[model samples]
Target: MNCLQSVGHSRFSALPWPKRVDAHHRRTAVFNGFVGTGSLRVAAMKTSSNSRSSLYEDETEEQASSLDAKMTDLSDREEKSEIYSSNMTQAMGAVLTYRHELGMNYNFIRPDLIVGSCLQTPADVDKLRSVGVKTIFCLQQNPDLEYFRVDINAIQQYSKELNGIHHYRAEIRDFDAFDLRMRLPAVVSKLSKIVDINGGVTYIHCTAGLGRAPAVALTYMYWVLGYQLDDAHKLLQSKRPCFPKLDAIRSATADILVGQWKARVTFKWDGDDCSSVDISGLDIGWGQSIPLKFDEEQGAWLLERELPEGRYEYKYIVDGEWVYNSNELVTSPNMDGHVNNYIEVFNEDVNIEARQRRKKFMDGDAELTTDERKMIRQFLDSYKDDADLDEEEAEVRASATSDAIASGTIGVPDKA
Candidate 1:
């Protein structure tokens, strides 16, 4: 199977994080690919602490000077910070100016992060390494690499040979919005490990560096770096000329609040007489369906899958007829304006009070009470603690207490 289809399978999408690769196998693969290049020893795998020892090593005076200038400029900049994006529109003029400045496909969007097009040649790897990039993150699928004649095996070999730079790949399809949204969390998680845990200057790229690469970079800044979504977009736009699917990024960030929790969800249908039944949605992807097996014991058709905590809209196809749940309370209009059954799956860790407020908002109760608004705000703020572990333990504990208050496990004086 091609990389795109392979990644779409449960092996990748079913997890909250990327599947771990064995270090030995990876080392062996690198060794085998670079056997004739010269006397080259395979270094630590991406997950190895030994590899990160050299992340900031061999710094040239030019690189140091460049980094210092960047930091100084960043400190001097006065960008307004907010918890939410008041406006989501792109700055078209800034985008054009940045694109004009980006003569090459690659440019440093941040001090530690470089967003660029696919690395087409081994020289490209050398170019990036010369700038102190310790990690190369490729977001293109196998087919995309082949189309560009990008020798990925050679790129990996070159990255390994150059100060043991880490080469990581996420097989995301070109222009696939759904795949981008679904896989973005895992992408950002790996990027976080490289930049935060490993202390590496990471270069992220896709086929053209226009779509997936920028999207991942923007999401990282927004989700992990605590920039508001619009601020993150503006930051990236000011550096690189590209359009990331912002809506998908926003959706992914929304999912992150509860993405850590996955519960085995079962969809049941009382279609005993129907010849077949199918259940779909919540990572099954709308318009696609997986069959529900007959359950004689329960006297119903059942489909069970581990789903991350979120509200999912789905419909049942019984004997080739699409139908929503008869109970209108659980039914909502789908994108096509058709009524569909919706389910809110959550674990005990979920802040039920905040969830209830969100559900009320979703159910057309836009006039939320003062307490409800506060609960929702606290819920979002509490999850921001996961953005950075280096934050104070006391602050994290307080966020946890906020979560408890939102969950109604802790009582607070009625401020309203």
Candidate 2:
């Protein structure tokens, strides 16, 4: 409920109560005291047109930093929740009728979307729109819709209304990296439409908005925000504190990163459940003549072999089915009337690739001890590029620079 004022009423009505077991049982609550003045920040929410910190008059600082946050305590949680909910009452109204602010359950990811729990009621939908949500992407199926219920017409009618919001759904299978990767194109395409056409804020959710939604959001961080994995994970955590600890997904994503779709190809096929997937390509020569067995530790059916630098058409044989890789590394028109997926090979620096991969695993500040990171962040918070400094400022600068030199980054550049 720590939001701006509510919007004027339109013909769009409240959402219907879903006919699922115990909707009340899973009531989402916000944590008030947990987000205030110190580590956590509430910046002007990100939008397509807004400048980097343009819209928000930070009740505090503008950006939430992953480097320095104290552990949130229960007493603080209770205290902050009361103060925040009191402020948000008018905006969230009865829809977000929980005791705490929304951050207990979700975060408004800057610049584009409100990544949060499934819309249980029209009230939640109203709460979202109150904060500039224009589109809703629900990834979970409403359990009530599985069979024709007695109130099917009314339910469908209500869903059609859905507060007059643009809604999309791309059913995700189980939460494996392979499944998520397969679904990425659809997810990206849908979100791209929202950005390209509607150009407003969006909300994407699953049943919990913790796992599936964030998985897709993390993918967006890599694709749209141009964030490496470390930065993306830190940024997501800094924004959505409740963001699920997806070590498996992280491991899978990291593992999957091993494969490159472009020149000097690296192809990965996550066939954990399947028997085999192979990179069958012309010009790669030998080894690929038969279906490739996926290396279990590799997390996918991986192919990294030296081939003369050039383009060549290829396809993945997954358990005997000829599947298009669709990564668009390369493609060609086949005589068989389908476009063949292809690969390109070029001399790549193995050492550089290794170093780049290593860099993705950790942020620049990762090597610093927690306390050192906090100290550096504090010093940086006061240091600004625009400001002119006097003697005291000069001393602080010199000392901080020396400390950095003593830290991990001051070492020799490694390339061999």
* Per-model lDDT: 0.58, 0.47
State in Å the error of residue 143, model 1. 6.9
Error of 1 at 344 (Å): 4.0
Candidate 1 structure quality by residue, lDDT tens digits, 1-416: 00011111111111122542222222111222433111124233455565464552333333444534543333222111010010111111112111211223788888888998777677887788788876788998886666434589998887656542567786665655556777876667656655543354889898667778999988777656666567778889899878786655644554543234678877788857889998644465443578989999888888888876556666677887767768533543423345667676667766877556444433433333455334434443443324443343343345445645765877998888
Q: What is candidate 1's TM-score against the reference?
A: 0.44
Off by over 4 Å in 2: 1-105, 141-164, 242-416
lDDT of 1 at 100: 13
Work out the TM-score per prediction: 0.44, 0.35
lDDT of 2 by residue, 1-416 (tens): 11222233212112222321221233222223334433445544567865556545443333333212212232233344344333233221222222221231458777776777655444565677677766677666444122111233342345446433455565654223234544554555455444444446877776446556777777656544456556777777777643332432342333334333324446666658878776554443211344565686876677765543334456666776656766555444433344556553444554577446534532232233344334433432343322332343454344334434555545645899
TM-score of 2: 0.35
Global CA lDDT computed for model 1? 0.58
